[model samples]
Target: MDMLFSLMSPQVFLLSCMVALLAGVIKGMVGFAMPMILISGLSSLISPELALAGLILPTVLTNGWQALRQGHAAAWGSVKRFRVFLLVGLVALLISAQLVRVIPHWVMLLLIGGPVSVFSIIQLLGWQFRLPERGHGWVEAGIGGFAGFLGGMSGVWGPPTVLYLTALDTAKTEQMRIQGVIYGLGAVALFGAHIGSGVVRAETLPFSVALLVPALAGTWLGFQIQDRIDQVAFKKATLLILLIAALNLVRRALIG
Candidate 1:
């Protein structure tokens, strides 16, 4: 508790709690965006290094909750189905996390921003493509690598994973499960990777653990609200938020 509270000022600490709560609500509703929200929101108020560490524990714990929410059988099924993607993605995440400790902050922002903006715009513009069935395995590997690299560097890999799954025409139920499985394992990989990279050291780990409460609590609350939303409207709203966030990332990168 002392170590966690020592990581930030009272004002900044309250802001982080709000950020975690909002990010949790969005994730609970849409099944993605917690890291993006946390990293992006916190970056302004704190060093990105500390913010990166702060997101780790909550992300890992919450993703684990999501993966097992439907029970072991469903979770395992999704894992088996996307085994290639998970394997490639997690490996890439582990390797690339090492790079994060060396890279400049602005460069990381460009990486996160560039892909997010392009993808969000593409998704909103309704461009469509279908992969030849047999070649999709390789495509999945590629997507996983890209997602993992992004995940390692920016603490976000959702956009590419979502695009790949969306392109594969995965049904709604399976898509969520697939996302949960991918993110859960990636979170595990991230925890391990960062431990060695010093992103999960004692000072940072406490702050991360402290935020888990708001993150998880707000997620549960958001799940209750998810059932009340219209799918079409909610999707448009989500995209708008992504676009805004993506642009903000770019702006930050440029100004720095």
Candidate 2:
């Protein structure tokens, strides 16, 4: 207990717990957004690399649960279809992790936030856009590369994966499942990468473990609330959160 107390500052610990609570709730309701919520909130207190490392285990565990429970057979199909892209993306992430000490977080924020904002706006506006079928291999590779690179840097892998899944016109259940599986896989990759790169260290373990309690409690509460909310309303709330997250990234890039 004394050791754990020493690992985290009072304010930082409190804030981390609160963010974990909120992120857990959001993930419970929407089946995604853990990284976005946690990273955004934690950035105020911790370095971006530390924040990214902090999320690795919990996000993986949570999403692994969701993927197996909800995705089941459908998730396998997604894995099979996108295996090449996924592998390539993981490779990119591994390579980028080596550069954590050298690369600036602001560059990653701009890369991830800029595209996410533009894509989200276009999607929200209901624009009809389609990737060409003939060049899908190249497209997949490009997105996978970018996703891996940025994911390693900023812990924001959702936008590229989300965009790809959206373009595929995946059903709602499949969408959630695919996200869960991808996130779980990414978490595993990130764990290895970060550990090797020394981004996740013994000093951070206590804080990570402490934050999990609030995360679990919040997720349970969110699950209860999910049944009471309409789908449209839930979607709207998710969009709002996404907007806020994007704006926060931009602010961090430009001002911080």
- Per-candidate TM equals 0.92, 0.89
Off by over 4 Å in 1: 132-134
Compared with the true structure, all predictions reach lDDT values of 0.81, 0.76
Candidate 1 structure, TM-score to reference: 0.92
Q: Give candidate 2 misplaced runs (Cα > 4 Å).
A: 132-135, 224-238
Please give the distance, in angstroms, between residue 79's alpha carbon in candidate 2 and its true position after superposition.
1.6
Q: On a 0 to 100 scale, what is the lDDT of residue 41 in model 1?
A: 90
lDDT of 1 at 117: 86
Give one digit per residue, the lDDT tens place, for model 2 in 18-132: 8999998988776677888888888887767667777777787777876776446767876887886788889998888888788887887777777777776776777745665
Distance from true position, residue 107, model 1, in Å? 1.7
How much is 34 displaced in model 2, in angstroms? 1.3
